[model samples]
Target chain A: MNWLMVVLGALAGAPLRYLTDRAVQVRHTTVFPWGTFGVNVTACALLGFLTGATTAATVPPALQHLVGPGLCATLSTYSTYSFETLRLAEAGAKFFAAANALVSVLAGLGAAYLAGALATALLG
Target chain B: MTREHPEDDAPAPGPEPKPTGWAAEPADPDTAIDPWPPKPGRPSRTPAREQAAILSVIALGGALGACARYGATLIWPTDPTAFPWTTFWTNVSGCAAMGVLMVLITERFTVHPLVRPFLGTGVLGGFTTFSTATIDTQRLLDGGRLATALLYVSATLAAALAAVWAAAALTRRAVV
Candidate 1:
């Protein structure tokens, strides 16, 4: 049952990342990977909220498996992020490459921090 | 990953000038680091049947990857106060595998388009998560383990990047 929930959530999450990347990349003009940036940060925020909720016992373990490990994990991809950063550097966009890594780490941390705080305040 | 111009695929009403900055190389769709905008001249909309097939494979691959990740955690659960070795190793190893996979598919062998989407975008993408890493750092910080938090964040970042670079470099030397 737990595994099934994870599989089902991933079914939605993985394709969502692909589709979201496709949508976001087309709208942008820069070589910077805004699509991945957007999804990663968003996933962090959602996972943060879910973590806080679980800590407060407002979220069940099953839901945690579905959303945390299944959905957000699939939605947020470190491999793609690293590959894009490497590609950017290889392509001579050194500044964008560094910015992509630095900014992503900072923004993802910030989103997680802020969302966790909000969840704790609301639930705990 | 080359910048893909949207106008390259979708029909345009007017003769708008293509944006400048990044050159759109006609890279093989199977080999692109990022799968967006779908190579330079290929039509964006594939047959509905093909699209469904691609999505199904991606979902199946994602489930396999996620299950493997979950299995790792169950096998090696970490204490909340201790370092998250499971996730750290998962990300590092996944990135390393991605390096090898990318080199093989793009540089060494010609493969079906679905292969990249399944293994690269679905499996490795699902296996290694940026969000969980960030949140793990936040939890450590919230618990007032400042030193461990900082160490975890920087160490994971450095190790993951180094693993990818070294793996790709080694694979390239070994194969090409």
Candidate 2:
């Protein structure tokens, strides 16, 4: 059951990331990767909510498996983030490269912290 | 393939000439998530059909990669208070693999258009997660382990970047 949930969630999450990336990328002209940044932060917030809910015992473990490991993990990607940073630096956009790495880490962590706090307050 | 004058025939025949760097490469979008920009002179397919095919491959690859990640965690569950070794290694290794794969597809080999979407964007993207890493750090901080959280976050970032850079450099030098 857990395995099936994970597969199903990934089937959804991966396609969603691709679509979101395309939609976001087309709208932006800046060299900064808002598409990947948007998806990663969004996933962090969602996983944060799920984690908090699980800790509060308000959500079932199966649901957590489906959403957390299955959905959020697939939706947010470290490899692409790092690769994009590498590409930026290689392209001589050193400032944007550094900003991309620093901002992404900070924003992702911030979103997770904020959403976790929100879920804990509401559910716990 | 012998050229009468390699300098004159600068446009070597392949998917694209080996990019010396991003400078030599065309000014395509730097983000690898975008589909390979349509090469000139190739027959165009129906846009909807191409998109559906790409999405299907991405879904399939994502499921496989996610399962492998889940299996790794199940096999090596971390203690609640301990660092997330499984996820850390997963991200680093996946980044390393991404480095090598990108060099190959872009420089060394001429792959089918869907290969990059499937392997790079789908499999490696699904395999290494940013959300889990950030949330795990958040959990550590919430538990009053600020030192551990800081170490975890910085170490993962540094190691992931270093791994990708080193992997790509080595792959370029050794393989290409």
Candidate 3:
């Protein structure tokens, strides 16, 4: 695999994560972590497409290193999710905490499924 | 590091004692300071140059973390229908490290502030991912492996949370 692809993708992914996180938080004035949720779904969609295309042999697996594990993983975070969940629980926003987890899982799966199907259709 | 924020060094707005001897052993020393976790978006006392340095460090760590994750996936290239054990373990372990690292830096150690953002935000953040886990589960469910999908999802979530909690608790008990 082209290791540079991983580095290149991360160079883009990490900064994009920071910028997108800041932008999302700036726009939404709520306790809900729209920032992390937004990036998680977006990255999942991209990962799904990458998986579909690579598994189908429509795209070189090397590119998978760049987009799938590199960009998507860096762009999406679990620490922030866990931290936010802990924070919400500590703050007694139990409902919002549950809602955040449920919504993130549901939306992430939905987006990934759709994107994977679309990639199969277009690339495969 | 730049000291451009003269106001920041001129005695913080909060009533915390100055870094006397660079060691804060309060009478209790039992709790993390209130107003803990400096507000996001609030500019740090570090100058723009130092902020840039920390950002670059984060980026460097991100590249290394991503490569490590990619290597793990390559070692065990599972088909889409199978449970992605590689990703699951990667996330669980990463979160566990994060829990320990955060407590060590924030509570136990008095290192540079940038150290947390660099290692925690950069390496551990990049190494662990929630998005790929969700997508993998969706792929399994779409492939009609509902049981496997459910198992993978719940198992990963539970493992990750437990790992973090256990690691954090262990670190605190040892240190404090």
Candidate 4:
């Protein structure tokens, strides 16, 4: 039953990622991979929220499996983010690449913290 | 400053040196050796447009890779307080596979340009994740498994970097 939910969630998450990435590409001309960055940060926040909700007893175990494993896994990315940063640095945009990396890490953590706190307050 | 003569860049005249290996004159005088070796009845060059086509193929491949990652997690659910085995294995296996496939496709087989984007950039990029790894390690630390979490965090980072290096080296060996 939990496995079934995971499959369904992945189905939804994967296509959503693809569509969102495409949309972001159409809207922006920046060389940075904003689509991937946005998705990953959002996913991290969602994971945090879900974790908090589950811990607070507001979300069920099964739902946690679906959203956390299935949806979150499909939504977040790390390899592309790393590879692109390296490419940018190699192409002589070292400062920009380093800033991008730092921002992603720090901002992602902040988003997760906010999401977790929000979920805890609202759900509890 | 006045510019130097173009002929000055050329090598000075010397006694004719004996050729080391193949005696055939290169097709391009600017290059000392043939970059592309002739194969029996095989074409010497690929079309330029093929490189551009790889991006779309990779994006589609990424979707599949992400889905596969979710599937692997489902099969091995980790306890909240314990080490995350599912993510660890997923990353390690993905890294190893990337290494092997890079060699086989880039060197041993005549892989289409589209295939590299699909498999290397899209699929592998999507399959293995570092964000989740970081989050999981932090969670483990927060949950009081400090030693396990530290080990997990360092191992993933070091191993993944090594894996990429190994893959690139293997591909170079097979090609050259």
Candidate 5:
């Protein structure tokens, strides 16, 4: 079952990653990968909500499995984020690279926290 | 330091004769050197067997990586209100591993092409997670540790990026 969940998550994550990357490329027309940042942040929030929901008295394990492992895993991507940052630095755009790094990390955490709180409040 | 070419210092001789192909003239000892070897061309289609092998490896590696990530969360237990150490360490360590692996695979090992899908894409992909990182940051803010959450997120992103760059740079240097 766990294996199944991982596979399903990956299937969802990979395509979403491709599409997000394409969208970012088309919109930004720059080297920076905004799509990855967007997805990672969103994924983080979803994960937080999943975690919060699981701990709550009303939520069930099945729900957590479907959403946490299946959805969040696919939604967030570390590899793309890492690759883009390096590309920026190599291109000598140190400031942009630094900003991308800072924004994703801080925003991701904030998003996750908010999601968790919202989920907890609503579900609890 | 000034460097001089020895050939340039030597006296010039008569004009060199133009080289001819094998069919045009007899093979000459001077023209025997082949600078570029003829490389075998790739097939028009990839073999099905190879594709299956790659997929299996990726799946197996992904499973292991995911399990390891899950284990990390369990090992580092923290309250929802406080900073989450498990997710932080998992991402950092995963990035570090990727850095080292990139070097090891490209430089040191004669890794099979399929190995990349399995280890690089599947295993490492599963090992490091962005979702957890994002959610953790949010949790920190919600829990009232706004500053810590912000700092943690920034540090993770910067460090992870640096790790890859450092790894690649080191590998290139080592190869050269």
Candidate 6:
């Protein structure tokens, strides 16, 4: 069941990632990788919500397997983040690279924090 | 293959396009690889038949990678209160492997086009997740494990970055 969910979630995630990246990158040509940033943070919020639901005992363990590791993990990526940051630094956009890394880390952490808190308050 | 200087014979016979870097989507809307070439430099390599195949490659690879991650979580299941070591190690290892894979594809080898979609965009993309890492930290912090949360967050970011850098550097030096 867990394996099936992972497959299903990732089937959706990989394409969504490509589409979102294309959509976000079309209008802008800067070094800041806004597409990846938005995708990562959005996935973080979703995963945080799932975690919170589990914490509140609202979501069963079996269901948690579907969205938490399944959707969220497949939806967001670390490898791309590392590469883009490296590319930016290599391209001499050191400031943008630094800012991208900082903002992504902070935004992801903050989004997850907020989602978890919100879920807890509403359900716990 | 002749080891001769045939550089002027119709654009050097383009090598099979491999995944150059992160997020090198084939169906990307903002493709700018060749602005002055008029029709761009990809339509021929991609053709019409290969485009659909690329999408399938991504889907299939994504499923494979996601299931692999799920298997890891099964082997190292973590409770709500415990550290999610499975995910941490997964991200770190995936980033490291990605570094090696990128260099191998872009520098050391000429791989098939499917290799990039299947491995780089699909498998590696699905294997290592930034979202789960943050949410795991949020879980720790919410449970009042401030120290653990801080350590986990910083350690993941630092280790992942270092892993990529180190692997890339080592691979480059070793190959060159």
Candidate 1 clashing pairs, residues 3+ apart or interchain = none
True contacts kept of each: 0.65, 0.76, 0.56, 0.17, 0.36, 0.68
Per-residue lDDT over A1-124 for candidate 2, one digit per residue giving the tens place of the 0 to 100 score: 8998888888888888877876776665577888889999999999988887788766866787889889999999999899888888887788888998999999998898788789899988
Ranking by lDDT: 2, 1, 6, 3, 5, 4
DockQ, per model, reads: 0.48, 0.50, 0.41, 0.15, 0.22, 0.46
For B28-47, candidate 4 gives per-residue lDDT tens digits of 11111114333435333334
Give chain A TM for each model in order.
0.96, 0.96, 0.93, 0.90, 0.87, 0.93
Interface root mean square deviation for model 5, in Å? 12.2
Name model 2 segments beyond 4 Å from true.
B1-46
Error of 5 at A94 (Å): 2.4
On lDDT, the stronger of 3 and 5 is 3
- TM-scores for every candidate against the unseen true structure: 0.85, 0.87, 0.80, 0.64, 0.65, 0.80
Instruction: Name the best candidate (by TM-score).
Output: 2
Instruction: Please give the distance, in angstroms, between residue B164's alpha carbon in candidate 3 and its true position after superposition.
Output: 1.6
Candidate 6: tens digits of C-alpha lDDT, residues A2-105: 66777888888876775576467554545578888888998988888777767776686556766776678887888878777776666566887788778898
**Candidates arranged by DockQ, highest first:** 2, 1, 6, 3, 5, 4
Where in model 3 is the C-alpha error above 4 Å?
Answer: A55-57, A120-124, B1-47
Evaluate residue B44 in candidate 6 and report its C-alpha lDDT on the 0 to 100 scale: 25
For model 6, the stretches where C-alpha displacement exceeds 4 angstroms are A60-62, A117-124, B1-50
lDDT of 4 at B77: 84
Candidate 4 local lDDT, A1-124, one digit each (tens): 6666555555555445544654564454455666667777887888888876776766766787678656676566555455445445544567757666667766766777778789889887
Residue B40 miss distance in model 6 (angstroms): 12
The segments of candidate 4 whose C-alpha lies over 4 angstroms from its true place after superposition are A26-30, B1-85, B95-126, B145-155
Q: Give per-residue CA lDDT, model 2, range B112-137, as digits (tens).
A: 98998899778998898999899888
CA RMSD of each candidate after superposition = 6.9, 6.8, 8.4, 10.6, 12.5, 8.0
Question: By DockQ, is 1 or 5 better?
Answer: 1
lDDT (tens digit, per residue) of candidate 5 on A61-122 = 55565567555765565765675666566556687677777777778767766877798898
What's the residue-level lDDT of A114 in candidate 6?
A: 83
Count of backbone clashes, every candidate in sequence: 0, 0, 0, 0, 8, 0
